[model samples]
Structure formats: structure tokens, C-alpha cells
Target: MRTVTRARLLIVCLLSLRYGGHDEPAAQSHGLFCASADAHPTPFILRFRKTDRAVILPAYLDHIFDAAAAIERKNARRYLYTNNNDSWEETPFNHPSTFDTLALDPGMGERIKADLDAFSKGESFYHRNGRAWKRGYLLYGPPGTGKSSLIAAIANYMQFDIYDLELTKVSNNADLKSLLMQTTRKSVIVIEDIDCSVKLSNRDGADEASEKATDSNTSCKLTLSGLLNFTDGLWSCCGEERIFIFTTNFKERIDLALLRPGRMDMHILLSYCTFHAFKKLARNYLGIQEHPMYLELDEAMRKTSIQLTPAAIAEILISNQDSPDVAIREVLAAFPKDMPNERAGNVDGGKCQLSHNESKQQTFRQTMFVFFQKTKHLR
Candidate 1:
């Protein structure tokens, strides 16, 4: 009986081994269920019931990680990224401007806000429509017209990062592309005074310059075509939810390519301060929407041919903050007598259109001019 039992056990073992060779091992069927590090260094579990299941696991994990990252970015505080050595670096983004504080035309502000809201919520819509999830804005105005301030206000309103792209620092088209790729989604890529930064000329002029430079062994050349490609090329669609803002005092100097319909989605002309804008400034600075002197100030602004920038008006109001009446009177008195129809000529076309530092000097000149005129009249 013992010999028979041994023979049966041997036969069963052989049968089991033969079947196992044809079928998968139990371990193979169960798969290696364990935690593994993802590309982002986040640990996640890997479980599989079949050999073919692992094929889809990486893609599944990637989707989950992407979703998580998108949520994190949406909630995270905004950053001000600057380019350094062809890479991006983050810095604390502390911009104090908001939509409420910004002195813009009521209708214009509302339109911009509406557009921003649509863009933020229309991810699926953009995909369905086969349109790039991006928007471009061209802000053209004189110095102190609040172009930079408007940018800050938009950034604050959208809770988006600001990538102040300094074209002069960039080496070439390749460097520009690299810098743009490094930028994350939901950020503003600003090229302030684009015309001044590079020689934004017609296609013929750019080609001629490129040809000359190719012959001469010069350093990196930034051509108009390269810039347009950077803004609206196929690579520009690599990232999503981005805003391209270009500011220039001389809109006429900007290349026609940039002004084309689809290139700059919106052409915003931030002209001189209107009475409506002044009312906003008054409410912001003096905390009074309707003061006794508002009518007089409105009349004064209407009668004056000079177009005062929001910055110039803001300085006058803040200077005499202690007394609302004094501030209003001072602002009214400061209106330039020579309301030249062409103040654009005063701006240095070769330099930055309207820098913050230059705004102060311009405001000082405006104030001093008004002060001198007033003093002379008193005498």
C-alpha cells in the first residue's frame, strides 16, 4: 500500500508540473502588487490581475498624477518667474493691484474680466473647438497710462504667474523657445515694449537683416519671424492656459504680423484717463464716490485738452491724502495747459516706452510745470 501511495503522489506531482508549464504560475496571475515611485517621485500602488494589465498601469498613473498636479497648480499662490541662463526661476509674487483698484473703463474692464472667466472655464470647449488654449493682448498707450499696472491687476485678478520675458537677455530663437517651454500653465508671458526690445520690422526687413547677419558671424539674432513663431507657432500650443501680453507706446511701429486678427486676440488702447476713470481713482484714494468737488473736477477734466494718465492723477490725489478737498483741488490745478494732441512725440521711441522709473520723472515734470504756472499767476 505504501509503494502504491508513493507512485500516485509521483504521478500527481508530474501532472501538476506539466499543467503549470502550459498555464501561468499563481504568482504570475496575481502580479507584483507593490508601491513604486512615479516620475514625479510620488509613491503609488501598482496592482495587476493579468500580465497585460501592467501595460495600461503607467498611463493610468500618469493621468492621476496629471490631474493632481493641475489641482495643485490651480490652488497654489501665483509666482513671478524670471529667466536666468535659459531656465526659469520662481520668486515671490506679491502684486497689490486688483481689478477693483485698476482704473479702467467700466465696459472695458467688464469685458476683459468676462473674457478671462470664459478662458479659465473653457478648457473642454477649447479642446472641442480645436483652438489653442491661449489669449493675446496688445496694450498700446503713452507712458504712465497704467499699462504695467493693468498687467499687474490682470495677474492679481486671475491669480496667475507673470513671466516678464526680457527679449534682450535671450540669445536667439532657440533660447526663446526653451524659456517659453519652461513656463508652467496659467501664467502671463509679458513682453513689455516689444518694439523697443527687438527690431520688429516687416518680413522683408527682417529677412534682409537675417541675411546680413548670417554673412557676418554675429551673435544670436532675434528676428520678427522668430518672435511671431514664439507667440503663435505650433510649439506655442505645447502648454495650455497662457496669456501673451505685448505693450508698446508706438503701436504704429509694431510689425503687421503681430497686429493681424488672430495674432493679437485683443487690441486694447489704454488712452488718457477719462472722467469715469477719475471717479474710480477718487473712490480708491479718497474713499468717496461722490464728493462736492467731483462735478468741478469733471468739468475741469472735460475742458482740458491734455489727457492725464491714471498714474499722474493718482500721484496728485495721494500727495494730499489727508484732505480730500485739497487732493481734488490739487489734481484739478495740475492739468497741463498745453494739451498737445501729440504727446507721443515727447516719448523716446528708441528707449522703453513707459517704465515705472520714467513715469515718476514725467509726473514730476507735469507737477512742476503746473506749480510754476500757478506761482507765476499768483505774482
Candidate 2:
């Protein structure tokens, strides 16, 4: 009887294993492993049945994918930085100037856009030509001109970060090269007031040491040759799709090597305001494109020998934006009588014509002094 009982128990156990004893499947734990600490954390899930396998596994995988995508997006945003003591320091580059909003000549603006577009597409072209993918621009004009504004427009248009290089802060050539290397690809490196930044002369070791000892803070020992090498030399080729811009109030003061054909691919002269540029400002400030006084203002600007900058005109237009007639009248009255000859036709199409005559320079100084004095109240 005991042997029979044992056999019956064994048969019962085997039948239960074959037929499934429990009503639900056992719970199984799944782990979602992340590659980095910065990655989004995924929740643990317990799966039990064929239905759960069909729904829960796929949903968990999708969540992991979404988290990874979020991480990538957070890391992709660029920033503006400046060189500080041989290192780059991040700063806000929130400039509110675009190609449309910028007061640049239409033709010139279009050409700039075309050049940028071509450069952006010239990766294969660069490789084919065996050239470094870079371009340089020299923006030369007097103070209050739109050189800085133009730089801002380029940055905004390209959606690229700016690296405003302060050459004065750099200690030596090595420091300058290091700063350049730290910059990432696809950025505009701007050196504003390049003429005033440093003497930019290649001196002997004794002279360099004496200057360094005399005034370390004011004078930069970096030579013009060193600067050129950094811009167009082998080191520059390390980065691709880069733009270098040098701005100066005195273009004639800059070294010839810097203004050479290959060095500065384009030399944009931001000259005094023209009727065409004035129209742009009018449109920007006042909504009306064709006012009754348009003809009068056009004639007045044509008659005037003294030229005003775009900024000066913009100030006048904005002050009486509500009253275009008043603004036009004020601009006409403020126009100096014994003004210098119109510098050049339109900055966009015109070549830079620098006059080195002392008498002309003296006259310009006096006239500009008076011009600023009158506009000072407007500011």
C-alpha cells in the first residue's frame, strides 16, 4: 500500500508540471542600463505574460531612445566665448541683428549671403582644391560706421558663435596660437579695432624685451607676421569652415601683408550714409516707404557735400519716427554747408579711396567735431 501511494504522488506532480499549476506567469525583472550619468534614468518594469511582452518591452525601449535623444539635443547648443588669459571664457552672444534688420546695402548683403552659402557647401570643393576651408574679411571705416554691426549680422545670419579675440590680452605668439586652437570649427573670430590693439611690429629680441619691461599691460608684442601665420598658416588649417574678420578705423595704418590678396579675401568699406542706405533706415524706422518728402530728402542728401554715417541718420529718423516730416527737416537743417566732397558713391560697390593730405584730414577732423557736437544732443 505504501509503494502504491508513492507512485500516485509522483504521477500527480508530473501532470501538474505539464498542465501549468498557477493561473498567472511568474514576474520577471528587466533592467534598462544607461551609458552615461548624464543620461535620463529609466524606470524598472516587471513583465509577466505574453500580453505584457507584446506591450511593455517595446514601450520601455522607446523610453530609453527618447531619453538618449534628449541628451543629444541638450549637448548640441553652441555658445559665444572670448579669450581670457589664454583660455576661452563663455559669454552671452545675444545680438539682435539679422541680414534683414541690418542696414547694409542690398547688393552687398546678397553677395555676403552668397559667399557664406558657397563656403558652407564647399566642403568637397575645399578637399578638391587642397585648400583650408576658411574666408577672411577686412571691415575698415571711421567710428560710428556699421563695421561692428556688420559683424553681428554675419554671426546672426550664419547662426554661428563668435570668438571676439582680444589681442592685447594675449601674452605671446604661443598664447595666440593656443587660443586659436581652442576655438571650435564654424565660428567667426573677430578682432575689433585691430589698428589700435597693438603696434604690430616685428622687433628684435632686445627691443621686444625693453617694450615688455616698459609697459606690459598696454603693448602687445605679437607681430603682424605672427598674426598672419595664425590666420593663413598651417595651424589655421586645423579648423575648417572658419571666418576671420579684422576691423579698423584706420585702414591705411594696417600692414600691407594683412591686406594682401589671399589674406583678406574681401575688403568691405563701410562709408558714410548714402541716399540708398538712408532709405533703408527710413523703412526700418518709419513704416512708410514712399512719403511725400521722400523726393525732398533725396534731393537734399544729393546736394549736401558733407556725408553723415548711417548711425547718425538712424538717430535722426528714430527721434521723430512719429513725424517723418520733422525728421527730414531736422536732417536737412543739420547738414553742414561747407562739407567735404561725397567720400564715395555707395560703400557696397565703391573702392576704398584714402586721402592722406594733411589739409583734408584737418578739415575732416573739424567738420566731424562739429557734426558730433550737433548730434550729441540727439543722443
Candidate 3:
């Protein structure tokens, strides 16, 4: 009877298993597994299937996951280069201010500080609402007047990199556009000698010299329209916060269209070094004070036809750096015997050329801390 009862219980359990019915143990607690399927499909997994279907995410999705995945892959792979170049190992640039090195024109410092502050803070009044971000400067004056130095100062002050774009290097308008696009924002893009770079529409053309009143399309290979587009076009607006400085010895040489109301925001005239500038240089380089020659020298400089540039004066100051007397003497020696009016054309034609005297170079290197300073004051 006991064996028959045991056989009946075993048959009952087997029949329950076959019908997919199970009884929980008396000690087992009731709870949920709490597992879920993926809420969204993978982009790659969806792409693998040949269907005109797409996976979309909510508008608020920041796409942080995709960015993280990209970063992870970048870390795993090494960038390969064909050439073994040590160029990347070059030391980082230690930006220095104009005050640390150069002797600048008086009132120049104040102007630069003001402009730089405006530029860095993104409040340069020229930038309009929803317009292209750029500033145009017409630095026109004789050579050795500090145009280049000013550029360096602006760059250093703003911690902005410089793109010294030579218009001649660009093959065409397209090439010019590519170079412009490659330039990073928060940079000063300089086009030195704009007057010489290309011919202007209003100017007398190449044929003008031979023929009487010739009109052979004064627009050189690079036209004024093209340059304007380069500065303030739809594509130009692509980059944000940039300054475009165009330096020229002859502002008149540039086309009128180039200097029109909206184009050149500021037309700064880097004139001859005045007595105030000279005094500043004296303090900077010679540390000279109330010398007996000061009055006489000032008078002489005022009367001289030689009309020394800030660069030329700086050269003299540097040469006589060790001996203030010597530097002043050199300046006096360069002074013209006859007092002449300030002449404009090619004023620095012969002045910038280095003499055979090694002393001049040595003095320049020793005395003037900021020899490469720019002439056009920004403020």
C-alpha cells in the first residue's frame, strides 16, 4: 500500500512538469526580475539593414554618447606621419608685451591698451548684430614707422595668433578664400603693403605711363570687389572675432572703393615721430633727464628737414644706448643743415638700410627693448 502511494505522488509531479506548471518552494519569496530591453536602436545596426528607414532621437538629446565614443576611438589609434619631423617639438611661444621690450611713440601706449581691451572683450563697436565679425585698419605712412611692431603688440596683448597673409602668395580668389578659412578665430590677419599688392580701379593702369589718359582696367589680378568679399562676405562671416589690418606706405594708392564708408573701419595715419615721441624714446633707451642739450636738440629736431621716423630715432637711441651723449650726437649728426617741410613719398627709402657699421647692429640689439613696435596707435 505504501509503495503504491509513493508511485501515485511521483506520477502527479511528472504530469505537472509536462504541462509547464510549477509550484514555488514554501521558503522562496515573491519578487520581480526588473530587467528591460534597449529603448533605442543603434545607428550602425540600423544602417546595416537595407531599408529606407532612419533612427531619430528627441530634439533635446545632446549627442554626448556619440562624442564620447569618438574620443575613445581617438585615444586607441595613433596618428601616423610619413616624415619624422621635430617641428612639433618647438617651444611654446612666450608672448611679451610692448612695455617689456620696445620704445613707442608717446600716447601710443594708451591707445593700444584701450583698443586691445575692447578687442579681447568682444565689444569692439564695429561688430554689428548678426553681421560678419571683423575689423579693418588702414595703417598708412612711410617705412620704419612701426606698422609691423604695432601688429606684434596687438597679437601679444590679445593672446591672438597672427596670420601674416601675403596677397601675392595666393594664386587666385579661391586660394585666398581657403587661406582665410583656415585661419582660426581670435586672430589678427595682416596684409602688409596693400597699396603695392594690387592695382586699383580708379588708379592709372600699367598702360597709363606710355599712353595719355589710358583706362586699361586698373584692377589688377586681385580686384577691390574680391578683397571686399574676402573681408565682409557671407563666407567671411564663417569665422568669428577677427581683425584685418592692411598696412600701406601710400593710402592714396589704394582704390577709393577699398576705403569706402563700410570697408576700412579705421584709417590710422602713422605720421613722423614728433618731439613727444623722441622724449619718450630718450627715457626708454638712454634714461636721459633734463640734459642741457635737451632744449637745443628739441629745437634742432623741430627744424630739421631729415624728418626722423620713430624707427630711425630708435636706431640712434639704440646705437648710443651705452652713452646717451653718443646716441644724441648720432641723432644730431643725422639732422639736416637746412630746415625743410615734411615730405611724404618714399620718406624712408634710404634710411632703413643697415650700414657697414657692426656697431649700429650691436647697439640696436642692446639698447631698444621694443624695436619692432608698430607706428599706428590703436586708441
Candidate 4:
């Protein structure tokens, strides 16, 4: 009879709960026999839990509450929030970014998706491991490497809210803690530009307990220890199924403690563009499988060692959408012959790199066009 209460708590629980009552076990054993087939909707259940009536069931009356809705919560609306006085100021987040649209390596993209799946389904795994049911991601790369886009993609994929935690706006550790505590479960808590967010003292620099109570400097700096606690400490456990994403333009500038395994479980580095990435972007933007200029561009990149960001390459493709030939040729000539040889950096020193790089490409478009125009005469 108590079966009336907890269907979800049991079915999705991965068998964590202890079984109840003698007859309950029998009922579960013969659960299929107890099953009565009735139409039910994923978005809703047209039923009632309790029954109360007299006068011979009181001539039972019920209304057919039939309707249709999206089970993935599309109508529920995703939100983006910013910290405000220990509360979140919400707005509709309509970013169209998704894994499908992302210019990520197929393998890296799949791995990230799989990791998210495992984490979302890891309630029992987390509980059994005696750890908080949360995952921390550190996205460090030069700007314009799709760090923000990846964040959007992740939010869209998980159907989670994005809380853009601006540490500079927070007054103190208490303020930071309050903001974090106010966040709900299944949220992506993002702190972008972590290196530049606050001037975090070294691990051995200041006493965190004292720093927590201290004052405002250029809009109050959150200490390293405080940031650490925010990620891996007791306060972070307040919400379940939370994802903490910390982005830095320069990973080398970050403190060692913050880069630790437990605090930043996944350190993703979105790096410079590669031929493979260019091909994917080409497919997305130009709708071309193979371009005559691809081999020339690829070979030029290998020879001159000029690296570009996806954003930069994308700009070329977009700016010259009418002509794929120009786009590829311009991309080829964009790299300067005298530019220093750079290694286009590895995705990360961790298992998942931006799931996943090197550095920024914000000015690459302007640079590319100017370079192309100047070099066109030589071509």
C-alpha cells in the first residue's frame, strides 16, 4: 500500500534503498503481475494519489486531465543568472549552442558528453564514494577559443541553469558562500577569467580565516583558500548535481592548489585551431566536404607553423561565405612567414582538455584580412 508514495525514488535510485516490509518484497518480486497497463504521458501523469469518499464511494468523479508537453523541459526555459546580494538575477538564456553546433573534435566532444552522462547518473557512485555529487571543470585557454561557447553548449546539453559567478562583484567570502548556497541543484556555476577575477594570494600567503572577514579592494578579492573551499570544501556540497567551471586565460598564472585534482576534476584547455577543426568549421559554415584549397592551406600551416583559433578561421569562413575558395586561400595566406614558431599547445595536462588549448584569437580576423590583402599581390 505504501507503494503509493515513492515510484521515482525507487525506480531511478539504482537500488540504493533497503527494501521494506515482507509483502512489499513479494509485491516487488511479482511487480509485473501487479502491473496494470494504462496510458501515461512523460510530461505529466493524469492521476490522483489519495482517495476519500463515503456514501458507497460517493459515485466516484474524475476529470480527464489530458495534455501534451515537452519532457526535456524545453518549455521550462533555461536561465542565466548573475550574483546579486546573495541572490541570482535571472534572465532567459536562449543561446542556441549545442554539441551538434560546437566546433569541437568529435572524440573530445563524445568524451565530454559521456563524462556528463556518467556524472548525471552518478548519484549512487558519488554517495558510495562519500563525496559530493558535483563535478569541477577548469577551462583555461587563450581568449576566443570557444570557452564561452563550450559553457553554453554544456548548459544546453545538461538542460541546466548557468550562474555566472563574478568574484569581483562579491564583497567577501560570506557573500561568495551566500551566492553559492542560494544556487539550486543541476546548475553550471561559472567563474570566468579566474586568473583576472581576483588577486588571489598564494597558498601560503595569508590566513584564510582572517581573510574571510576582511574588506574590499577593487571590489573585494576572494582569497585562494576561499575559492578552494568554494570548489571542494563543505559549502560547495550545499547543492547537488552542480558543475563548477573556472576559466583562465593563462593557466600557468594560476595557483597550484586551485589546479589540484579534486578541486578541478577536469581541466579543459581549448587551444588554437587545427586542420581538423578547420575542416569541421568548413563543413558547418561553408557546407563543403572537401575544398581544393584545403591541402594547400593545411600544408602551409604545417610549413609556416602559423596557428589560428576556430573563431578566427570561422570569421574567415563567415566573412567569405559566398566564396569558399577565397576563404580557404585567405586563410592560407593569413599566416605570416616570419611569425615565431609556436607549438599550438596541448589541450590540457589532464584527462579532459577544454573536455578537452593554447591562446587567444580575438584580433585574428582583422589580422588575417590585413595580411591577406597585403599578401594577395604576391600570390
Tell me the alpha-carbon RMSD of every candidate: 14.4, 14.0, 19.8, 9.4
Candidate 3 residue-wise lDDT, 1-379, digit = tens: 1222221111111111111242333212221111112333322111111121122222112344555554564343221111111111122334453644444555566776776676556644546555566677777766677787777777666656677776554434565676767767777778888866644332232443322212342322444455777887777777877888889876766767777644577766665566667777788888875566777777776665455577778876876689888777666665555755344233443222222353244345433433432221242
Per-model C-alpha lDDT, please? 0.72, 0.70, 0.55, 0.70
> Which lDDT tens digits does candidate 2 get at residues 47-136?
234434445446645765776664563455556788887899997777777777667765988998898889878999988999898889
What C-alpha lDDT, on a 0 to 100 scale, does residue 19 get in candidate 4?
29
Extract clashing residue pairs from model 4. 142-359, 268-353, 268-354, 269-354, 269-357, 270-357, 271-357, 271-358, 352-355, 353-356
Clash pairs of candidate 2?
none
Pairs of residues at least 3 apart in sequence or in different chains that clash in candidate 3: 101-369, 101-370, 102-370, 146-374, 146-375, 149-372, 149-373, 149-374, 150-374
lDDT of 4: 0.70
Q: Could you tell me the lDDT of residue 278 within candidate 3?
A: 77
Model 3 spans with C-alpha error above 4 angstroms = 1-105, 123-128, 200-221, 336-379
Residue runs of model 4 more than 4 Å from their true location after superposition: 1-72, 202-221, 336-379
Error of 4 at 131 (Å): 0.6
**Largest lDDT belongs to which candidate?**
1
Off by over 4 Å in 2: 1-78, 203-219, 336-379
* Model 4: lowest-lDDT 10 consecutive positions: 60-69
Query: Count of backbone clashes for each model?
Result: 0, 0, 9, 10
The order of the candidates by TM-score, greatest first, is: 4, 2, 1, 3
Q: Which candidate ranks first by TM-score, i.e. highest?
A: 4
Cα misplacement distance, residue 350 of candidate 4 (Å): 15
* 285-305: candidate 4 lDDT, tens digit per residue: 888999877777776765554
